[model samples]
Target chain A: MKHMTLLAGALALSTALTGGALAQTELSLWYHGAGNAVEREILVGIIDDFNSSQSDWKVVLEEFPQAAYNDSVVAAAVAGNLPDIIDVDGPVMPNWAWAGYMQPLQLSEGALDGFLPGAIGKYNDEVYSVGLWDAAIAMYARKSVLEKHDIRIPTLDQPWTKEEFDEILVKLKDSGEFDYALDLGMADQSEWYPYAFGPFLWSFGGDMVDRSSYTTAEGALNGDAALEFGDWWQSLFTRDLVPGTSQDMADRETGFIDGKYALQWNGNWFGIKTLEAVGDDLLFLPAPDFGNGPKIGAASWQFGVSATSDHPDGASAFIGFAIQDKYLAAFSDGIGLIPATAEAAAMTKSYAPGGPLEVFFGLSEAQAMLRPVTPGYVVEALEFRKALSDIANGADVADALDAATDAINADIARNNNYAPAN
Target chain B: MAAVAPTNQRLKTSLRYLLLVLVGAVFIFPIIFMVVSSLKPDGQLLRDTASIRAFLPVGDISLDNYFAAFKRAPVGLFVFNSLLVTGITVIGSLFLCSMAAFAFAFLEFKGKEIVLSLIIATLIIPFETIAVPMLMVVNSLPSIGPDGLTWGWLNSYQVQIVPFLADALTIFLFVQYFRDLPKELIEAARLDGARWFQVYSLVIVPISGPVFATAAILKFLAMYNQYLWPLMVTQSEQFRPVMVGLQYFFQLNTAWGEVMAYLSLITLPVLAFYLFLQRAFIASIASTGIKG
Candidate 1:
C-alpha cells in the first residue's frame, strides 16, 4: 500500500511538469539567415535558451534567405500570415512599420542605451527594431602602396579633401601600376550603389531625400551639391581613375588584393579575408571628405514584432532576451560585423580593442549615419542607384539627378507621402 | 563531271557539319563553364573566368562545393519538393486543359466561342499582376488534411499545385493542337454513338501524344522554375523548392562555387525531363508551327 502511494505521487508530479510546459505560448519568429550555418546555430541556441529559461513563452524559428526575406514578409502580411516576430533590415524597418506590417517595439526603458545609433531602427519617434550588429564601409588600401606613392595616410578627423582625393586617384592611374586607381565595385549594381555611393553624395551635402520633410526629394537630390557629387562620380569613370559600370565583377573582388587596383571601397565583412591576404600592410582608411565630411552607409538587420501578432509582449520578450551582450558577441564573432554595444564589442575577438577589425568599430562609432528614415526611402534608394549608374555610364549629371528627384516626388505623391495607416 | 559534282556535295556537307558543331558549342559553353567552375574553389574560379581555363577543370578540382552547398540548404528536400509540385501540376494541367480544349474544339454550346476567346485572352495578363490577389484568395481557402479541415493553405504542397493546375498557356497549347486534329476523326467517333467524354478519352487523347509531350515539357519547365509564388506562399523551409533554395548561396559574399554547384545540380532534372520527351516535343512543334 505504501509503494502504490509513492507511484501515484510520482505520476502527479510528472503530469504537473508536462502541464507547465503546455501552458507556455508558442511564438513564431521569422529570421533572414537561412543559409548561414553559423547564424542558424547561434540563433537556434538562443531560441533554445530562451525557451528553457522562461515558462510563459516558447519561441519557434523559421528562417528565410536574406534575398527573399522582405518579399516573404510582405506576402505574409498580405495573406495575414505574418509570424509573431521578424528580423528586418534596419533601413527597411520604417517602410514596414509605415505599411502596418510591423509595430513599434516595446522593450524595457534604457534597454537600448549604449547601442550604436545606426543599429536602432527608429521611425516617427518610435523604436521599430533593434540590431545586434552594424556594418561600416572603409576605403581599403595597402599601406605599402600608399607609402610607396608618397601619399599621406588620412585619419578619421582629417580625411582627404575632395581635391586631394581626386588628385591622388589621377596620380595613381597615371603611374600605370594599376588597371584603375580604384575599384568602386561598380559590378555590384544592387544596394551597393546606394549603400556605398550614397555616402559620397551625403559627404557633398546632398541626400537621397530631404530628411526634414520626409515627403519630397526635391532640393536634396537635385540640388547643386548633388550635381557636383554626380559630376565628380562621373569624372572618375571618364578620367579612367575608376572602372566603369561595365567593370568585371571578378576584378572588383580581386583587383586590390591582386595588385591591379590601388584602392577598394568595401565593408568590414571582407576585412578578415583581406587582412589574412595582406597581413599588417592592409589599411581600412576613412572615406575621403567631399567637403561635407567623411561618411559611409550604416545599419544592418534587426528584430521587430509583427503588427498582426497576437502576443507582442512575448515577441518583445524574445527580442529583448536576444540582445544580451553574449548573443551579440556570438553573432559578431560568427560574422565579422560591428557589435552594437561597446560591451559586446569587448567580448568579440574581431571587434574587441586592439583586434584586427577594431578600426571598423571606431569607424562605426565616429561616422556611421542612418540612411533616410522615411518610408519613401524605399523608392529614393532605387532612384539614387539608377542616377548613379547612369552618371557612371556618362549620362548628363543634372539630368539624372533631376529625373531621380521627379520620380521620388511622384511616388511620394502617389502614396500620400506614405502616411501612417493608423 | 559527275564525280566533280559528288565531290562538291561532300564539301558542302562537311561545311554544314562544321557550322552545326560550332553553333552547338556556342550553346553548350556556359553549361560547361558552370560545371567546371563548380569543381574549383572561389578564388580559382574568379581568376579563371578571365581565361579559357574557366571551361577546363585544370586546377584543384573537387566536389567540395557540392558538399558545402548541401550543408547550406536542404538540397535534397528542395529538389524533391520541386519535383513533386511540378509533377502534380503538369499532369493535372495536361488533363484539365486538354478536356477544356476538347469541348471548345468539338462540343457546340451557347457562348462557346466567347468563352474560348476569353480563356485565350488571359494569356496577356502577367502572373505578377494577379499574384497578390490570388495569394489572398488562396490564403482564405479551406483545406482538408489529416488534421481535418484547416482554413489556410499557405504552407502546403496543394497551395503550390492547385492554383497552377490550369494556366492559360497550357490551355492554349491544347486548344490549338485539338483544333487541327483532322475533324473527321472526332466526327467518326461521334457517329459511332460515342459520348463527348468517350471521344476525348479514346479518339483525341490517344492521337495527341506529341501535343501532350509538348504541353507536358513546357508546363514542366514553367512549374519547375517557380520562385515567386512558392516564396510568398510557403514560409516553411520544408516546402521550399529548388529555385527559392538557390538563394541560399547568395550571401553578402556569395559563394560563387557553391552557386554554380547548385545550378548544375538543379539543371540535371530539367535536362533529363527534356531529353526524355525530346522526340515527341520536336514532332509536335514541327506539325503545329508553334514554338513553345
Candidate 2:
C-alpha cells in the first residue's frame, strides 16, 4: 500500500510539472514569514540565492501572512496542490505528518545524531519533522520600572510560588508607579496563550490532553492542578491585576514599555522585537513554576520538507546550511531564539552580543517543556485554550475543563486513535 | 420668481456653504491625522495627540519608512499586477455587462423574464457561499488542458479574470439604465436599417455615456480593492496584487509608522481616480433620480 501511494504521489507530481507549458523544474515552497517587509525581503533573498546557486531546480517562494498561512496550506492540500516545502508552527507538524500530508525524513548517515534529541519526534519510529529553532515563553520586566519600586530582580531558575507571584503584584501596586502589577494576558490568546498560559498549566504539572502511550498525558484540561492554575489565573483579572478588555494582548506589552505594567509574560520573540521598539531596558526571567512542575513555554516553529519533494536531499542540506553555526548565530542573533543545534547554540552564546542572546540560549536546559507533539494537538490545543479563556472569565474551571477534555478526546478518537507500534 | 425673495436665496446659499465646510472638515480631519501620524516617530503613535512639530521630523523625518516599506516586499510587482487585473476588469465589465443589459432591455429574446429572474437570483446568494466551489474551479483550470496535467493556467490572468468576467450586479446596473433609455431612439436606429449590434455600439453606447461611466467607475473600484481571491490564486509575490501587498504591510503591526506610510501611498491612486471621475460619476448616479 505504501509503495502504491508513493508511486501515485510521484505520478501526480510529475504530471503537475510537465503538465505546465514551461520546461523549467519548478519547486513550490510555501512560507508564512511575510508579516514584515523586512522579513519578506529576507525570505525573497533566500529564494533568489537558492535559485541562483542551483541549476537543476528553481525554487518558487510563496508566502501568506501568518494569520492566513494555515488556511491556505490546508486549502492547497485539499486540492492536491501542496507545496514542495512548508514552514509551519511546530504544533501542527504531527497532524500533517499523521494524515500523510507530509513525508518523513530518512536521514543520511550521522544526520540524525547531529540535532538535539528532544527536537525530533517519531511516530511508528519514523521521524516526521525536525525543529529548525527553539523558542520559549518567559517573564519580562523593565529594569528602570523594577528599580523605581526598589525590587531586586527575581532569579529565573527559581520557580516562584503562587503566593510569591501575588506578593510581587502587591508590591508593584503599592509602589504607585504603575497601574497594574502584572499583565496576565487573557485578551488575545491567539499569540500569547500558548507561551504564557501553556507554561502556567505545565508549572502545575497539567497536560492539555492524555496520550500517555504517546507521552502526552491527556488530563491537563480536567485535572486538579490545571483547575488550580485556572483559578489563580482568574484571580489576576478578578482582582484587576490585568485588564479584561479585548486589547489586553497589545495593551500589556505596550503598557510594560510605557511603564504601566511591572511584569509581563511574553516569549523570547517579543524580546528582540521589543528591544528594537524600545531599546534594551528589558530583562528576562523563567516563568514561575511553583515547584509542582517545570516552567515550559510552547515551542514556536520548525522547518520541514515535503514528502512529495523531488530533492529531499537538497532540502535537508539547505536546512543544515540555514541553521549552521555561523548562519544560526547570524539569523537568531537579533531574533531572540536559542539555536536548535547544540554547536550552533553554544557558538551563539559565546559570541552573541550585549549578553541578551546568552539569556535566551541559557534557558534551553534550565527549566522548559515542549507543547505536546500529538496528531490532534492543533485542534485540541485551540479548544483547550478557549476553555482556559472561559475559566479566566469566571466560568466554572472544572466544568469548562471537562468540556475541553471531551472535545480533545473526541478529536483524538476521530483521527483513528492510532496506537504507535513499537 | 415673486415667491423667491433675494433674502431667502441669500440665506439658502449661506446654509449650503456652512454645511459644505462642516462636512469637508469632518472628512478631511482623519486624513490630516493619517498624514501627520505617518510623519511621526514610533513612540508618538499612541500618544493620542502629537505636536505639529512632530510632523516636521527635525532631522528625524526621513523617507526611511517608505523606503523600508518598499524594500520589505515586491511593492512594484504588486502594483503592476493590480493595474493589469483592475484595468482589464474595468474594460471587460463595461463592455460585456452593457451589452447584456441592452439585450435584456431592448431585444425580444426567448424567456426574457425568466433569464432576468435567474440573473437576479445570483445576487441573492452570498458570494461567500459559493467561494469554495469557485476556488476549486480556479485551481482545477490548469489541469483542464489537453494533457490534463498542467498548472500554468491556474496562476495566470485567466484564472483571476475569468471567474469575475460578468458580475451580476454590473449587468443589473446596465439593464436598469437601458430600461430608462428612450425606446423611440432604438426604433429610429432600426428604421435607418441599422443592425442591433450597430445600434448598441454607435447609438445606444454614445447616448448611454453617463451609465457606462458609472459602471466603469464602480467596476474599477471593486477590482482595485479586491484581496481574497487574488491572495488564494496567486502562487508567488511576483504575481500578487496591491490589496494583498497592503494587507501584508498591516500584518507587520510592530512597524506602525511604515504601515501608515504604505497605506497613504496605496490610497493615493484610488483617491486620484475618484477625483478624476467625480463629475461624471455624480451625473451618472444623479441621472437615476427618476427610476424606470
Error of 1 at A200 (Å): 0.5
Best by lDDT: 1
lDDT per residue (tens digit) for residues A284-334 in model 2: 776665647557654556667776677776666555444445555544553
In the range B1-292, model 2's lDDT, one tens digit per residue, is 8667987999999999999999998898777766666765655554434345433434345666677778666777877787788888788888898889899999997999899889988989987677667778777665555676775445667766777779888899889888988999999999999999999998899888778777777777788888777766666667778877775664424566777777777777778877887777788878875221
Best by TM-score: 1
- The runs of at least 3 residues in candidate 1 whose Cα sits more than 4 Å from the true structure, single-residue gaps closed, are A1-3
Superposed Cα deviation of residue B265, candidate 1 (Å): 1.0
Docking class of 2: acceptable
- State how far residue A195 of model 1 sits from its true place (Å): 1.0
The total number of steric clashes, by the backbone 3 Å criterion, in model 2 comes to: 8
TM-score of 1: 0.98
Write down the TM-score of every candidate: 0.98, 0.82
Candidate 2 chain A: 10-residue stretch with minimal lDDT: A349-358
Error of 2 at A28 (Å): 4.6
